[model samples]
Structure formats: C-alpha cells, structure tokens
Target: MKEDYAFITEQGESTVHELSTVEALIKYQEQFHTGFPLTDKEAEMILGYMEGHDYVLGEVQGNFYQGDLAEVRERICWEEYSMDDVIDAVCEWNYELVLEAEAQRNNPEDFVDFAKSQSRYERLKAEEATLD
Candidate 1:
C-alpha cells in the first residue's frame, strides 16, 4: 500500500486541505494538477521521502506547485515573496517562456506571447496598475 500524505496548514489544526498517496502524487504531477509553496510542514514531509519517488504538489488557485522549488529559492535570496508573486511569477511566468520567445519551443495559442515575455517582477508591477 502507498503512504498517504496530508497537507496540514495552520500548524495544530486538524483540517487537511489535500491528501494523496505517493503513487498518486506522481500521477498528479504528470497531469499538471499539483499545487505549490507547500505549507511549512508539507515541505518537511516531501524531504522525508526518498528521491526519485513520485510526489504530488498541492495546488492553490490552479497555479504554482511544489515543482518550483528552484525558482522559489532564487527569488527568496532577494527578499520575501508576496501572494501576487506566487501567482503570476512562479505560476504563470516560467523560464520556458524565453525558449518560446526565441522560437525554440511551442505553446498553446491562448498563451499570449507578449504576456509571457515579461519577467515575474515586471508582471507584478504591471498587475499593480490594473488593480488600481
């Protein structure tokens, strides 16, 4: 039987937002259905697992997930990340955008070229104007 993991937010609270087994985690990842930034404890659980084993990322708002650890580390070196940063930058913006912009990759048509061209920082700034 596969071990099931639960994301327990707010520390001692008994509520679990999402739960999945190791096998299911990998399956969810392949399907792009996982979430991101994992709660503090969730990160610990992920680290406890052996490498190469499948794990699913917990999702929020249909974007951002555990797969972005590298990018998140890079951003954290500078300063704290805001919610908008997580949504637009980590989730919507990606390094692959550069490849697509350079014509080295292909993406779905609804994904706007101009929008993906902006860096996460730039996109956050532009979004501020829209919110005003």
Candidate 2:
C-alpha cells in the first residue's frame, strides 16, 4: 500500500498532514508544476521522487508510510519485525524506488521491472529479519 503526506505551515509553525495518494499527487503537481494529467509512469516517478526526499517543501516532509507504519505492520501481520526494522525497510524501499525511477527517466529505453523490484524488497525484508 502507498501512503502520502504533505507539510502545511500556519502561524509560523509547520505540521505534517496525511492525505490520500491521489491528493498528494495533485498537491505535488500544483507545487512543482510537473504538468497536469500525469501518466501512470510519470505519476509513479513523481511519487518516487517525492518519497525520496525528507522535505517536499519548507517544513513539509514526505516519506513512505511516514506515520502509518505501525498500522501497516499490524494490518499485514508483520509481528516479527520491530518498529525500527519497519522504518529501515520503508526508507530502503523508497530509495530503491527513486533510484529506479531516475534510471528509467534518464534512459528512455530502460523500463522498470516491478517483479524484480518486489523480489528485491522481499529479500531486504528477509535479510532484516535474519539480522535480528
């Protein structure tokens, strides 16, 4: 599952706001001017780029599963992993996604292999489990 976040500032204070992925995408386009009517691949790339950053905008942050990691683990019955492990996994996964997106963006002939990406992500999780 994918999650989205935005940063909103009011009265000299900033807070992270969780929103649906579609809403986040729209906000992203509005802020970045990447263009309207983004294609699926383009949207994926934008999400990847967004998640790769610590702050999407001033005082606003973006990261995969930023505030919902615990719920996500519980929903998926990932009882064996610690919160820190989950955080690491999410960070690594986002980094990999961003790298893949950048690579594909730079090389038009190159295509993203979701199967490979999933396999690698699972392997990372397995490795993290074994480290415990």
Candidate 3:
C-alpha cells in the first residue's frame, strides 16, 4: 500500500488532507496557498532536491510521514543539508530568475542604452547586497 503524507507548516500546522504523491503535494501548495508559500517552479526544485538526496516525498522538515513523523523529524534535524538549505537555494534561484526577467524587460537596443541598463542592474545588485 502507498504511504500517506501531509504538508506541515513551519508553525506546526498541517494540511487538512493527507497527500499521497509528489504531484498531490504540489497541487496542495498551489491550491491552498497555506504553509510555506512556493511557486510551482520552486516547489518542483525543492522536491527534486529532496528526492535526489534520498528523502521520501513529504519527508522534509515541514511535512508529516504517516507513522514515522517523529522519526523523520529527528532524522531531518541531523541531516547535513536540511530543508532550510534547500529553501535557501530555491530562493536564490528564484531571485536570479527575477533579476534576469527584469533585465530582459528593460532590454536596451543601442550601445548607450545597454550601458545604462548594465549600470542600473549593477546598482540594483549593490542595493540588494546592502539589504542582505
């Protein structure tokens, strides 16, 4: 029989229904807008990372693994690359995507305009660095 799972929130709340697959988890995230908010791409990226690292679907920190929920949580706590690390990586990836989209939106035709856009992009990066 397939094991059931649930998407738990950082605040200790969980989804109303038990999810059965990676696809269901993604759908819950997209439809409910509860728990840690994630875009479709971000969710897929994080899930992929978990799977690549041998974590079962919904076995990360913010999830419930049926009867093994406590054990799963304990194991995750000791993991070298925990869910937080994956989340940070995803956030960084999304930020880069945003920056690229912004650059494309401001696409400049002439050399002078290209120089100006480059200068603006640099300035934005510096400001973002300061904020960090």
Q: Compare the candidates by TM-score and give the number of the best one.
A: 3
RMSD of each: 13.9, 14.0, 11.4
**Cα-based lDDT at residue 121, candidate 3:** 69
User: Residue-wise lDDT of candidate 1 within 93-130, one digit each (tens)?
Assistant: 33333334544223434546534544443644443433
Give the C-alpha lDDT of model 1.
0.35
Q: lDDT value for candidate 3?
A: 0.49
Q: Using TM-score as the measure, what is the rank order of every candidate, best first?
A: 3, 2, 1
Q: How many residue pairs clash in all the candidates, one count each?
A: 6, 0, 0
Q: For residue 64, give model 1's deviation from the true position in Å.
A: 11
- Which stretches in model 2 have alpha-carbon errors above 4 Å? 1-78, 109-132
Candidate 2 vs 3: which has more lDDT: 3
Clashing pairs in 3: none
| Candidate 2 displacement at residue 3 in angstroms | 19
Ranking by lDDT: 3, 2, 1
Candidates 1 and 3, the one with greater TM-score: 3
TM-score of 3: 0.31
lDDT of 2: 0.41
